[model samples]
Target: MKRTLVIGDIHGGLKALIQVLERAKVTTDDTLIFLGDYIDGWSESAQTIQYLIELSEKQECIFIKGNHDVWCEDYLRIGKANRTWLFHGGALTFEGYQQLSDEEKKKHLNFFERMKLYYVDDNNNLFIHAGYTSMKGPEQEFYKSNYNWDRTLWEMVLTMDKRVKKHSVLYPKRLKIYNEIYIGHTPTLYYNIETPMNAINVWNIDTGAAFTGKLTVLDVNTKQYWQSDNVNELYPNEKGRN
Candidate 1:
């Protein structure tokens, strides 16, 4: 059966990304929706982007832009690295790109340039790298950065009162618009949960591959998921945004 799989943040851990893909037995029949942050932490930041570029040739894939991706794209375009971004894993990503030729770098930059802020499916399923703030929908969002930086949507749902009904005015209008919302910027490991998390209709897939956490992939409809081993363990010699 064909399946739509939503993947968590990669943070440049290509090994873990490969592991979860294999663990989930992914095939061309599967549609992979990566929740971005494809680069920044691990040693394979550049290689991971190249891999994704190649992978798209074999299957249906949608790439959502994450905050880290923004940083990478900016560096590629302007040739100036942001100090704040470098402190948070951008250093390794930049170092990784040093190995690529000018032409390869240009190709990779094009790849980043094409990333989407958000994607909505025929079933009204929302897929975004981070959270959006607009109540109407991502399309009507006033602040475009919120698509790749907002955390309030996740936090609100995380703390939402369980007693509130979906139809109640007390319930969030944001949550009412979609059948389900999937995001990745906020890692589940931040809360000490090393797996995918679901709060109300929102699914948080980022398992923190940037730190000591695993990479994750979930079947959007069934909620059945697969995860990789701790990413730090895969590249012990490198400190991955820890």
Candidate 2:
């Protein structure tokens, strides 16, 4: 049977991405849903995007837009972003991007342009780069900006006591809207978790690949996951935004 694999924030860790794919034993028939943040941090942002472009050509892939990705896109189109983007990891992305040819830049920019803020699969599973609030489905159009930046939804999931029967009262009906929700952006490392974590109906797959953790890819149907070696190990000589 064909499988759907959801990937976490890559953050330009191209080596980590390759390792995770190898560990997952990905097949061309498998569907890959990337939770975005494909650039920033590591030194391989340009190569990472190019690889994803090639992967899409032969494999089923869905790319979701992440906040870092939005920053990169904005910088490419208008040459501007907030200081957070510039100081955090955007400078590294810019350096990597500068190494690309003009044609490569155009192609990568187009890929960013085509990315979605969120996606809902036939199984009613929501795949988003970040969280979503407004208690509405993806089609409801509550706040377009929040589609790639919201953290409240995932935060709510983290704080609610899943062991309690009354946990439903803590969140909106939207919390129950999907059979499962997979997201990246807020790294699991912030919660002291170094792997994919399940909270309520949400799965956080960002294992802080941009920082001290590894890249992660999870099979949506089986809940089986694969992880890369520590991202820092892949780029031993680089500071990687630290």
Candidate 3:
């Protein structure tokens, strides 16, 4: 069986991310999947994008668009939008951008636009930035428009009757898209949590690394999780940054 490493939200902690990857000992043959939130929160947003772009070029790395990344793209396109961008850990992303040269800023913005909303491998493992949508029927039909910046769909998935939420109600008939689905966005107390219904099937890898929690990575096949010990201590005063 091929080994797949699914990573949770990096939140611009490049130091912690590099350490996690090094610890995982990722190689060219292994598939490394990132469940978005690549930028925003700590610092080094631009550098994080550059590093992911470089890694994508060299190895089998798949990226999904996280909500924060959507905010970054919007800020780059229109300079501003909702206050959620500033409130939900976007100020650090702005700080990272300010540290970059004009050319680098342009490069990272372009890269962000090209990120995929979801990645589904041949093995059936689904990787999404946030939670999966609650829309049903055909996969392509739902993913085409619903996957991009659809907060309503994400909310439904997160709060839907906890019992059915584990399995993709968005497309009930086709729930077996993969052996399991890996996601971020919702931080869990544990580095990884298996759905009560599915045992070790559905995995939530976000351990609130940007807040008072740890960053997480999981080996899907083995169900082994790796986590950072500390949060970004220098995240800056949230109120002041906003």
Candidate 4:
């Protein structure tokens, strides 16, 4: 059977990304679902996106829009650059982007523009870059902006009891929306773990590649995961998101 490989935040760590992909043994027959934040930490942000674009031609790829990606889109669209975004490793992305040709810049822009806020596959598996706020499924008419910005969704899951009855009552609508939900953005390192974590059916896969953690790729169906060495080690001389 074909597999679906869901990856975590890349944060411009091209080496880590490549390592995880090879470790996972991803193939053209498999579907690669990226939770986003592809750029903005390591120095190879543009190169990372370029690699993904090339990968898409060989396999099925689903790219989700991350908060950092939103910052990237804003800059590409209006030439607007946010200082806060810059401070959060966006400068690295800007630097890498400058080395791209005009055609390459357009390709990157198009890739960012086409990313989705959230995706619910036929199996009711939800893939999103950040926590979502609404409980009325992905179609609810809420602030669409929160799709890539909210934290309450995962926060609630993290704080709630993993027991079924208790969680069902507290997050009844949320749990009813999908069989499983996978997200990036909030790194697992915040919880002191450097691997994908599960809580109340939600999987937090951002292993803090932008920090000192690793880049992770998980098989959504089998729950088997693979990771690169600590992201910090991959770039011995360069500072990550700091």
Candidate 5:
């Protein structure tokens, strides 16, 4: 049977990304769903995007946009760097793009332009970069920023998982909408977790490749996961989004 692999935040660690794919034994038959933040942090952000563009040509892939991705896209389109972005790993991404030609930049920009904020599969599994506020669904969400920035969804699940029964009237209706929901903006590392973390049906796959943790790939159906060596270990000389 084919696997539907859900990938976590990359944060420009192309080596870690490649390692996880190899460790997972990914093939064209597998469907890859990336939770975004493809760039920023490490020194290889531009090269990472190039690899993904090539990877998608033959493999089945779905890309969701994250907050860091938005910053990269903005810089590529407007040619002005955000000071806030620079503080949070954008400087590395800016430097990575410096060597690329204008045509290549446009192609990369187009790739970012095509990213989706959220996607719901036939099985009602939600793949979003971050949490949403809408009780109905992400489509019902008014502020699109929540799709890239909110942490309340995960926070709620963590707080309520043991307190409320899923069938209880007090259980979160938002969690009831999907069979499973996968997200990446908030790192599992923040919770001192080195692997994917789960509360109820929400899976937090961001193992913090942007910082000191590893990159992870999850088989959405089997819940079997593979991880790369710590990104900090991969680039000892570079401080990755520290």
Candidate 6:
């Protein structure tokens, strides 16, 4: 059995992320799959992206595109547009970029553009930056739609039941695709539940890392979970609002 480490959203909390990786004892032999949101939120967005890119070159690392990443790509690709980029934690991400040189910034932006939206292993486990709603069809379609989708569409998909909704056409019946779908986004608290879902074979690992949540990781084969101590207490003012 291949040992894979699935990581949750890392919203620029470089210190916290480093601790989690160290705790996981990541080795050259193991695969590290990041679910995205590598930038924005804390103070190390640029650094985090650089580190991940470096790691990718050294080992097998899968990078997925988070909503924030999409915004970053847009902001860099287009001269200007929606301020939503700045409003939705882009300010922090921009701040992180300030710490880097012009050349470094260009390099990171190039990397962000090349990230994949989702990763599906032969074993059946699906990895996506965020959970999908019923509106999309087929895994590939979901990936394409999500890359350019707006929040309203995403919300609609999340609110409706995948089985009965027209959008659910894209997703294979839960049992047919794989036993579990590992996803990020839609903070766990939005579900107002403790202990993230493992039922329907869906495991949400986001853990609200940007707010009063801890960054998380789980071993695919063993299902062993690990988390960083809640760093929210240290940044009380930035919780939820960020």
Residue-level lDDT tens digits of model 2 in 1-242: 79999999998999999999999999998999999999999989989999999999998999999989998888777755567887979888888777878777888889999998899999999999888776667667578877788888888887887675534575567777888999998888888889899988889999999998999999999999999999998999987766
Cα-based RMSD of the predictions, in order? 0.8, 1.8, 4.7, 1.5, 0.8, 4.4
Full ranking by lDDT: 5, 1, 2, 4, 6, 3
TM-score for all predictions? Answer: 0.98, 0.94, 0.77, 0.95, 0.98, 0.81
What number of backbone clashes does candidate 5 have, counting pairs of residues 3 or more apart or in separate chains?
0
> Which segments of model 6 are wrong by more than 4 Å?
79-81, 133-137, 140-143, 147-175, 192-195, 233-242
lDDT of 1 by residue, 152-206 (tens): 9999999988899899999899889999999999988789999999898999999
lDDT of 2: 0.88
lDDT by residue for model 3 (146-227), tens: 4434434334334545465435544343344456666677666443532211223456677676665667778877777676
Q: Please give the CA lDDT of all the candidate structures.
A: 0.93, 0.88, 0.67, 0.88, 0.95, 0.70
Off by over 4 Å in 4: 166-171
lDDT of 4 by residue, 196-227 (tens): 99988899999999999999999998999999
Question: Given candidate 1, what's the lDDT at residue 97?
Answer: 85
Q: lDDT (0-100) at residue 90 of candidate 4?
A: 96
TM-score of 4: 0.95
Deviation from native of the Cα of residue 172 in model 4, angstroms: 2.8
